[model samples]
Target: MQIMSNENAHSETDLRAEGVRVTRQRLAILHVLREASDHPRAEDILTRARLQDPSVSQATVYRTLAMLEKAGTVLRNEFDGAGARYELADRHHHDHLIDLDTGVVVEFQSPRIEQLQAEIAAELGYEIEWHRLELYGRKAT
Candidate 1:
């Protein structure tokens, strides 16, 4: 299982392409997300964004996150019924393993699992539009 990378780092131009109003706060938020491997919550984003631009606000973080998710530039995951954690949507398809005890998220890709899902979908006479696989577990005792 490989952790995600900055392969899809976004910029102000991305927001413009998404037809969003580009601002310093938004750019700082984007920078924070681009540098994050661990999917972060809005509060974490706001805190990091403020480090990049002191003018960033909590409302702006939430609003920008909503805009990015709506624009399909970011993805919101509610693992273990937890508050939304976010990651860039452009990364290669992968599944997650959440540490139930520590609330850590690990990203991994598996072709065998992908093939099995496709096979199952075919058996069900349905096509998969999209899917999310999350496994919650703890370290071996």
Candidate 2:
């Protein structure tokens, strides 16, 4: 395995902090996730990881992803009928806008929508704990 850079080394530290073992396969998968610009599926991750370490297995990648998700270090999104895509959990909250026509995923934040959600929850005499909002629509011509 190639020596991890400072950026990826931090990811190793994060995995350790999450009480996960720092295995070669896990590190390879984590590296792939960190370098990805788009949220990628398990198959995509496995493919990229294999390019780095041929010994990395699909089962290992899947298991590592599940472990990361359980530790709240990764976010898994199942868009429409497509398979799950994974991304690192963001420090700031945001929602997703999926383009039905092109399968594009857009991340956005809206203060007005957030405030409206809070107000609606208050009106129902319930405090908002956690929520997920996903908007799906086709691109305008």
Candidate 3:
């Protein structure tokens, strides 16, 4: 079994400070999110976490994911009209492009698009705090 070092223990401290109760399942879910390169659906997370903690129930995982999303510790985006995919939000929010053919998601950050959005919102005399941009397309054959 791996030991939790002082530094690793501090992450739990930080998470609790963010209003999340520290639990084995919550920590497991957080670990999965941190290690996931591709945002995963709730089912994906549940399946992966169950391998780590067999006692982890689907309902617990789903509830934990919802709490994490509400705390802004994770972000959720829907792709191809399917369920929402989740990713850990550290810094720098970006957009997603989902390949409808292969079911792959590509993340991209564009300053030009960000500037255009700000300008357009300003033109409409509205202030934008957050936004979600998801582009869906199929791969070329």
Every model's TM-score: 0.93, 0.87, 0.86
Model 2, 24-124: lDDT tens digits are 88888888887875678899999999999999998998898999999888889998869999877744677788888877777777888889999999999
User: What is the Cα-based lDDT of residue 127 in candidate 3?
Assistant: 86
Candidate 3 matches the true fold with a TM-score of 0.86
The candidates, ranked best first by lDDT, are 1, 2, 3
Return the clash pairs for model 1, or none.
none
Q: Model-by-model lDDT, in order?
A: 0.87, 0.81, 0.78
**Model 1: per-residue Cα lDDT over 81-137, one tens digit each:** 879999888789989999998988988888888889999999999889999999999
How does residue 75 of candidate 2 score in lDDT?
Answer: 83
Candidate 2 residue pairs in backbone clash: none
Task: Please report, as a residue range, the 10-residue window in candidate 1 with the lowest summed lDDT.
Answer: 1-10
Query: Which structure among the candidates has the greatest lDDT?
Result: 1
Error of 2 at 47 (Å): 1.1
lDDT, candidate 2, residue 102? 75
Determine which window of 10 residues in candidate 3 has minimal summed lDDT: 1-10
Candidate 2 error regions (>4 Å): 1-10
